[model samples]
Target: MTHTILGANGTIATELIPVLKKHNVNIRLVSRTPQHVEGTESITADALDSEQLLSAILGSDVVYLTIGLVYNAKIWEEQWPVIMRNVINACKTTGAKLVFFDNIYMYGKVDGIITEETPYNYISKKGKVRAELAKMLLKEMASGNIEATIARAADFFGPRATEKSIPSVLVFEKLKAGSTAQWLINPNVPRSLNYTPDIAEALYILATNEKAFGQVWHLPTPAPLTGKEFVKLAAKHLKSSDKISVLPKWLLKIIGLLNPFMKEAYEMNYQNEFPLHLSSAKFEKAFAFKPTSYEDAVKETALWHLNR
Candidate 1:
């Protein structure tokens, strides 16, 4: 079996490559600026281009959509549908299965723990876009156009996570520099987040399992932690000051008025305003895998940041 990983350089894909390699399948890593690696074939292509994507995915058994778009709402609104359509069409044409690494944006604000059965109550513009794209994929799956599975996860942090991710920018970097850490919304609200390797492993497990098709699975994550706890844990591991401050939603909104990324993030601040934890019982029942504990995850992440 050949697995083509789109956005091969992404945080999740970086971790996923080794997992897929352990399965001994041929790997093709694709991205706009791809690099040749020892164990995989590398290709350069714009995933938004149907022909380019088809060329990269042909003769592959699975296509993993680990692509990360720029952190701009307007860009996501314009690009997500087009990218999904191209990938779906290519998968249909080539008989490759799709494993999409999705987020919980479509669920908006949920009442209790989020399960696979969570309804789409689109709140923000980005959430609506996510809901629509997910619906499009599900419709295609229902029609038997493609074999696909959606792996939904909360905000993630792991090895090689960029500054764009909340944990990396606010927690890891600040710890590395011995600077005071800052977080969005209330730092005391317990929120769920998956370690990157866990998410990657789950994606591979779901892609390999036939029963996982045409469904959405929340990847397994250990117990939830508040923003303060998350940072304090890392501080303990790094022996740095645990001093942290919360960034008010109003301040983020004011900053977003001029900054595109902050502007888009302001709309999603609802996630931090309240606790939103994802439940993974369905995934554990299917795969019997547990995610890494927060202590171990934070240690590894802190080490990675120190080295980076």
Candidate 2:
């Protein structure tokens, strides 16, 4: 089987390549500047260009759309729809199944645990874009135009995700540098996080299983820890101080003026103000999968940072 990954060099794709190699499947990595990996084909293509995307996906049994656009809301609003449409069209033309790596932003601020059945009630600009992309793909799936599965994850953390993982940026990196850890808004609200390795493995399982298409699956994630609990656990593993400073909304607003990332992050800060829990019960029951424990995950992440 030939499995092609779009947006190679990303945290999930980097981790997933090894899993695909273990299965001895032919792998193709596609990006504007894809790195050459042993036992895999590399294709240079821009996902936004219809011809390039279609060419990259040709002759594949499965295509994984793992592309992450720029963090700016304006960029996302302008680019996401075009990319999604291009990928869908390419997959349809190529007769390849699609596995979309997605996030929980579309679910917005759920009052309870976020499930696959959660409705799209997005609050921020980014969330609205996500909901539109998801709905577009769902419409195609419902119309029998594509064989695809949506694999959603909460904010993720693990090795190789230091730059993108919120916990890594606020807790692990800060503590490692002998500085106080930071948490957004409330430190007591529960926050769910998916370990990157687990996400990679689950994506592979979904791609290989014939029964897994045409539906949404929440990739398995362990129980959530409050921001304080998360920082404390990370501190225990790192042998550092657990003192945390919370970034209040007003402060974030002020910081947003000078920092582009902070500007985008300010609107999404609502996620941390309340209990953000994700349920992977559907996927766990279907696949009989067990997620890594929080303690083990934290220890492994801390060790990785130390070694690096």
Candidate 3:
């Protein structure tokens, strides 16, 4: 078996590397500036270039689209379509199965626990982009052009997930320093989060299963936790004070004035305002595997940050 990972340095890819290798699967890790991962071949390629992407995936059995764009709505709108099209086209040319790592943004705001059946009702720049890309892949799969599966994960937190996840950059970084941790929106509202390793494992399972193709699976994850609850759990693991503060919208706006990333975050703040719960009952029922408990995940993340 052979696997080609498109964004090999990403959190999920980094975690998935070991699982794929352990299965004795030949691995090709692709990135713009590729670095060697033990026991895997590393290649430099741009995912947006169909020729380059096709070349990287030439001899692979499964191709994982784990690439991510910067946190800007305009960039997502301009780039995601082209990137998805390129990957889809490349897979078509190479005859490789695709396993897309997706998110819950397309579902938007929901009244109850989000399931795969949730209708696409929310309207946001990022949400629309995700919805469109997902639809595109499914359409291709339906037409028998490519065999593909989609694995959707929630806000992720685990080892090597430092760049964009809340647990690392927002909560643990400050709590480890004995400073108050900052969170966005209503800190009391529970939100779904997935351990990065669990997500990687779920994607791997999907890639190897023939029945999973042409379907969307919510990766197994524990119940939701509020920012306050999450920070307290981290504090318990770190043996530090569990002090947390919610950043008001006005304050975030002021901070956004100078920081482009902060400015872009404002549009997606709706997720924090409401309880965004993702249900993995279908996946768990099918695979008979449960996600890592929240406490253990927090402990592992706390240790990772402490060691860093």
Ordered from best to worst lDDT, the candidate numbers read 2, 1, 3
Give the CA lDDT, 0 to 100, for residue 69 in model 1.
Answer: 96
Q: Tens digit of lDDT per residue, candidate 2, span 1-308?
A: 99999999888999899999999999999999999999999999999999999999999999999998889999999999999999999999999999999998898989988899999999999999999999999999999999999999988999878788889999999999999999999999888999999999999999999889999999989989899998998999889999999999899999999999999988788788999999999999999999998999899999998888
Clashing residue pairs found in predicted model 1: none
For TM-score, the strongest prediction is 2
The TM-scores of all predictions, comma-separated, are: 0.97, 0.98, 0.97
The lDDT of each candidate is 0.90, 0.93, 0.89
Tens-digit lDDT string for candidate 3 (183-205):
88788998999999899889989
Descending-TM-score candidate ranking:
2, 3, 1
How many residue pairs clash per model?
0, 0, 0
Better of 1 and 3 by TM-score: 3
Stretches of candidate 1 off by over 4 Å are none
Q: Is candidate 2 or candidate 3 better by TM-score?
A: 2
lDDT top scorer: 2
lDDT of 3 at 169: 82
How far is 136's C-alpha from truth in model 2 (Å)?
0.8
Off by over 4 Å in 2: none
Model 1: weakest 10-residue lDDT segment is 158-167
